[model samples]
Target: PDTTVVVGPGGSFEVPLNPPLTNGETVTVIVTDPAGNSSTPVTVEAPDTTAPAPATDVQVAPDGSSVTGNAEPGATVGVDTDGDGQPDTTVVVGPGGNFEVPLNPPLTNGETVTVIVTDPAGNSSTPVTAEAPDFPDAPQVNASNGSVLSGTAEAGVTIVITDGNGNPIGQTSADANGSWSFTPGSQLPDGTVVNVVARDAAGNSSPATSITVDGVAPNAPVVEPSNGSELSGTAEPGSSVTLTDGNGNPIGQTTADANGNWSFTPSTPLPDGTVVNVVARDAAGNSSPPASVTVDAVAPATPTVDPSNGTTLSGTAEPGATVTLTDGNGNPIGQVTADGSGNWTFTPSTPLPNGTVVNATATDPSGNASSPASVTVDAVAPATPVVNPSNGTTLSGTAEPGATVTLTDGNGNPIGQVTADGSGNWSFTPTTPLPNGTVVNATATDASGNTSAGSSVTVD
Candidate 1:
């Protein structure tokens, strides 16, 4: 028999052994305390050599909470969480039969963790699961910036904000006053690219909306021929024109001045006579389509002469005598006649004295007439002559050797003459410099009487 003792609150007592025990023999043991208390007789069938069945009711603490439990004395509490078939956490039960199985690791909200309690006996309990309440989903994000200018995005344009993951953050409508706003954090992260999908309450976003955040403006569009007024004149290659706004900010620049005008000849020239806009813009992004002008590429016609009238010259004329005239084109016209014995006469097929200009081509039929003779065929005398380098006027120019220069009055009469020195320089000591607005004729005659075409000089 196997003997054992039982102890009560009052005193200890002996256990009666029955049927002398033998190794591996089954036996029963009973014990009574002094207080007459007795433990239910324990059957000590030979030492329980067989392993104890696995523990029951083994479980991990509830999720998000902790747990405490008792384990077999001197046994290890093995926990297999996630059911991967491996022990994650373990706690050794001391001889005192106290043990604690902690949750494997902290779990996130909305996550579930399974825990299996295993004892040193190599037996495991069914897995116990704990779940964390789902956390609030990341706030939806929605936001977009836009413009209120002509291109699009007028005030009252709807703007939607979305989350970084493209989820709708919130629903917002614009106010009638053309403005709308949302409370911060009622949505997701601030300053994020809020994909503001805005639609007018009228369901009108067909054209789509543009956005400008935090007072930023959209990129300015490119404008051609920028801004300026129209110009008229012959514009040749290499010419440029100035372009500026009312405020004087250069927006478009083109070269035309070199060619007497500006040319915007496109790579593909605009169809002939095509009217186009010549726009100007300001630096502030303001534009002016109002100042546009039409383009006319056709040039003006050349002038023509119109004198077919007959005319006659009187008085003694030298062999080199010349007559001055004018054609319908305003070009100087001249004619000359033969002379013999210091006398000459010219009768034109067309009558003169009608303010026409003519040149007299008088020659000895040998040498060129001393500077082809030029004569004015007007009923009245020529306009008053205003000499340049007038009386006492200083002259600066290259003069030919032995050059004799003479200043003439309105009637081709000499006013003053100067003889060039050996250095080809000559100065007439005029009474005074020529007065402004005065017209005068000048003639340079070589020693051979060969005179140069008359030149007119006007004082500034």
Candidate 2:
């Protein structure tokens, strides 16, 4: 008995235990009555004294930030994060017998920890061990040009590649040097971003890294109509483009603007018939197939004109070219087409006057024109001469200056010639004395090669 109580009226009394009994503890109590009367002794039992079961399946987080396990319900759990033989953290098991303990400053990777569970009655279970897993680091992705992707990660870790939608696409493993590579079954489109993660053997995944797929090359550039001196085109926005000639010589380089437009002017003009090749390169270093354009910048050859007889004119020019005739004052005269054989002819609507000049040009199909060619019209001849009667030994005449005078026999056979002086006076002595009644004839010719009608007279 722990305490005694005085008897009350009707023989009723009470006894109190000063200190509570421990789990599974027992105590015997006896009742005492007045006049030294004694009652039977009885034993009272306390709560259960069994210790909690040892924590099972103890696991430390891969990041070492937490510990988790199963234990007896309503039990207290202790964790020794540093394995120092003392608990650094504690937690109470839930009604479901599951517990989780957090570490303030996460334990180092691969660190070993100890865990124990104790019941409410103060009975402790055997210790359990858990280790913090070493998580792999994010991979370093390399810049790629095609379908193949490569990177570096922790050695012996598995690498996983996923599309932007988080769908798994491929898998590989890092080598001893931490280098890894993956090739998709099918080619990826250009500018596709893929996610990559490194997974260690313990099933711990690292933060995701990204790599952009650039398997498809850019579309062939769209070239604008250009002269040989300057080039312009459209390509992938912000990409670099290179120009080359037919002989594969580098001409120049330029970058496409935000609108995909590009232009370049060479220091020297490119010759006609140049085959220019252009290639587009994107930021990822992928080059497109060469696009080609032929240059047609040269003008047609100058035309050749024949002498005009005042009525009809003829010439030669580049085949299929448009021939245009203009006068000395640049006024349009007539237009004609050169035949396939390069032959061309032009006839004035009305006969041109003597000494009129004509100019001709040839324009090719490309609209390039040749230099002008010229010809002069000359159709009229000089005036006839005036002859004087002859003295047989000295035949004289008044005629156009520079005119030649001749003497002939009555039969119009065998003649002698002489030229008129600047004063238009002329004389010619017959090699033989002209017989009486013999005739003489004279004629004049101008610089244009036209001959005048002859004048005649009889000799004395």
Candidate 3:
């Protein structure tokens, strides 16, 4: 039954809907006079013309990074990444009613995946849901060579590799069905030890797996001196060398050239006949057997003499070396061998003339001869420069022009020395003032380095 309202004559009336009308229903109203006369009726329609389907059959990623579902074509799909009712991202569905939405941070495996489809008119469908997958097993990685390393792991997992010290070296991802491989940009050396780990889509990493590689070392190099004191050797082309002392301690290292030639010089000269240990190593850390050698290539000690004109000469040299004494003309005068104490002495055939140049040579047991050490003879002394007994510290007189004048105390300690001018006049002042009654001596030396008898004086 329809309800009716009556109003007082001479006015319009207002109607209020307390409960509101149902959607999609039509209503009609008619006006009549008190005499029971009916007027024309008016009709009105309610709002609501369209409905869009919400997303359905949603599939969530095992890692919870994204979700996929079917929605009305041309509709937008939104995902609630945080499991909250509100969507964090919205993506338009393809014409075929397919849609996919990604989440920056993957959701939990057991977390609910809420998704809704919004139509062009802003109408939203019922939300859909799908569960995430479970975590898979850790990956199994294999050993590697200098180049490629292959292994197997959970599908879509990332393989991370590091050196034994936990330094990152390389990384790769596994394909569907769990097969994976990694190839380093550079070649790895033999005997290189490394660790490998697997990272799942959820960012969970597996325990590290240790792997050791084997490599072959180059043949022991032939280490010899490069003409002098440098250590030179040959090894695998492009390899390197580590040098050690007799005690097998590292002393130096060097890389081989393209031709496998390497050389290294010590900061200081090594002692003669010293033993140095050496080994050849490659980039892979593989090393050849240590090769040992005695450093006997050094020259023998140069022969020397105490006095240039002495009838007998003595000096230290390599033990068991042959020492030969020769005149200025290169004629051998005498020969001797150094004793175990490295001491040697040689005497000329007779008293040698003054100004004679004597040279000595030493040949070590290895037949290496030393450079000639020479001394000139100074037999005839220069005329002693004149000095008065009361001259104090001043000493001056005449001798060979350009000769040296030496002043000394009675005890032979040199006071001073001066060279005569072209005119042969010379003088010297004592660095320490002379004391009265002190005895001083003076001598003169010619260009030949001949010293004259000492002339004495008592300081005034």
- Return the TM-score for each candidate structure: 0.26, 0.40, 0.36
What C-alpha RMSD separates each model from the true structure? Answer: 22.7, 17.1, 17.6
The global C-alpha lDDT for each of the candidates, from Candidate 1 onward, is 0.45, 0.81, 0.74
Candidate 3 C-alpha lDDT tens digits along 1-460: 1545676566766555545555457667777778998778877665543557767778877667888878889877877766668888999889898887887767664667778787776677777777776545556766455576777887788888888778888988889978987777886777777787888777767767776764676788887643226677787777778888887777798888999988888887666667777788765456788887677776776866655445566777778888888889998778899999888877666767876787888887545689988877666777777775454556666667777888778888778888988987877767666888777787887754467887777887
Q: Quick one: ranking by TM-score, best first?
A: 2, 3, 1
Question: Candidate 2 residues 264-367, lDDT tens each?
Answer: 89898777888899999886668888898877687788998876656777889999889999888988889999999999988888977787898999987645
Candidate 2 residue pairs that clash? none
Model 2 lDDT on a 0 to 1 scale: 0.81
Superposition error at 47 for model 3 (Å)? 5.3
Off by over 4 Å in 1: 1-76, 92-106, 109-112, 119-123, 144-460
lDDT of 1 at 458: 58
Stretches off by above 4 angstroms in model 3 are 1-18, 21-67, 70-74, 78-98, 101-116, 123-197, 200-214, 222-240, 253-267, 283-285, 291-460
Largest lDDT belongs to which candidate?
2
- lDDT of residue 401 for candidate 3: 76
Candidates sorted by lDDT, best first: 2, 3, 1
